[model samples]
Target: MSNTSRDAVLARIRQGLAAGPAPLPPRPDFAAPVHPPLNNPDIVVAFAESFQRVGGEFYYCESLEQLAVQLAAFQERQQVGPPYVWESDLQAVLQAAGIEFLADEADFIANADLSLTSCEALVARTGSVLVSAATESGRRLSIYPDQHLVLARPSQVVAEIGDALRVMQERYGAQQLPSMVSLTTGPSRTADIEKTLVLGAHGPRRIALFLLEEEENNG
Candidate 1:
């Protein structure tokens, strides 16, 4: 409270600092993984389990036809208007399947209900999808819609989050990294309201991932 007492406190603090900085706390092994391996062997299975546990819909498509059928059913069941798709790759698949989509930049969000987008990679360990602003899907198309439908191949699935980051770097490292690189684990949810859980409070109410098998692409 007194100036003298304050000066003494400051002097003591300076003396302690002069003695040398306090030893740092024991540091963790930076090289080691923060999380243990899932050890599930089947990365795809690991992904499905973690994803569904958090209210994500996991669909395994043996063939493109099956993917189309399931996607159409999801569209019809939810009664969401035509999905918004931007990427040419996804557009080709949709066209082949005869699934109509809204890709016009001006009208894409006019009546958006379902958003079908491609992802960078799938993190099997965390059930997360790595998305970026660099792609045609951009950002809002995946988050603003009532339902988000990700179209990915099994080959894109990786063992951990680090692997997903690696993929992001490898793809866009030459160019500046995308303005946004997001790892979305599941549908948006919040329990901040009196501890009562609510889904889709901020984003999509439903999140579905369809992993098309590699062989299907050969055919």
Candidate 2:
């Protein structure tokens, strides 16, 4: 074959090799059950247990006030210095506990040692904090800080992943929704080296959850 033809043949072979196999579509997330776990004792226990299995601490309180108090105490014990953050009404909760609310600015997340966020829904089964982008304050405060404190009510606790999706749909219409919806299960953790669990490798090392009983009343 002439030099030009030989080059063309090699190019064709290269193209064939590069073609390879078609890309596979990503696996879809498994959907949770559609039914809510409201007033279900058995479901509640199971949900709480699952959270514990995932290295999360769960608590049931009489009221949101008590939960807030517990959170304050926990913060003190954990040595989480603040400049704490509350989305809106969370200010009242933290203020009552004497934790100052840091103002939101460019340096807000970088400067603050801890953050307190009140979320709309909690997936108890997964111990995930559901944060919609619609709540700008909550989203920023939760992810940016070194330690995240989430206040969730039992009423706000949904049974499974599907239930959370329903709540999100209700909060933000099907068409229009915030760009980010984070299902944060726990503090950022990794076991990169010799398989030893290392906390805070990616983000916050500590995540304290306050399962406020009366979410509406607290707000």
Candidate 3:
């Protein structure tokens, strides 16, 4: 009886297939509207506002020299000693400014008062910094430190997440993607304990972004 029922079901399926392909529904018209690309000035403003709203601090530096000055001030204010840093152009700047940084070692991240690293891209729409395992900082450096400082250039800022992903794809290609990617919007926080909000519960209590803007030449 089971065999007979199976045969009947198969026969019905075959009959339906023999009836030719079913007609597809008509495609919708009404062309989707396209949003204009955000200008650099607007993108900068939006990113700063969004980032600050989430308890993050934003600083604008006109050049590498300005960045160095800001970092010196920040280090003094936070009283951080030998911040943890990965290999990047910022290292030279930090060194020139006499700002000592711990060697890029996993074990030193927890003891360091602050961690400094470069980000992949800055999302203007959400004010998130995208980082990947391919970077020297790896996956643990950003979260383990008490304070996180990101060094980003103005050219790295994008309008949205899709734009940031596209930048990554263009930079590394799809075939050779990083092991992991993280989009951090702000310092870690939680309200799980008795509904009282707390910062640094899971990660850094303070997150600061320093954006370096280069002066363009008309000549």
lDDT for position 85 in model 1: 90
Model 1, span 99-218: residue lDDT tens: 788877665556777888999998888889888888898989888988899988888989998888888888888477999888888998899999998989998888999888875463
Question: Which pairs, if any, clash in model 3?
Answer: none
lDDT of 3 by residue, 39-136 (tens): 44678787888788778889998765677778888988988776788767767767755667777675683476788888899998778999898888
Q: lDDT tens string, model 2, 1-219? A: 999999999999999889997789997767964555544366556656766667666666566467656766776887865645546677776666555567466477457677777776777667677876676464567776778777666677777877888888887888876788888787788898999999878767777677665645645
Decreasing TM-score order of the candidates: 1, 3, 2
Better of 2 and 3 by TM-score: 3
Off by over 4 Å in 2: 1-42, 96-99, 104-110, 215-219
Candidate 1 segments exceeding 4 Å error: 1-33, 215-218
Distance from true position, residue 133, model 1, in Å? 0.5
Greater lDDT among 1 and 2 belongs to: 1
lDDT of 3 at 155: 81
TM-score of 2: 0.70
Model 1 clash count equals 0
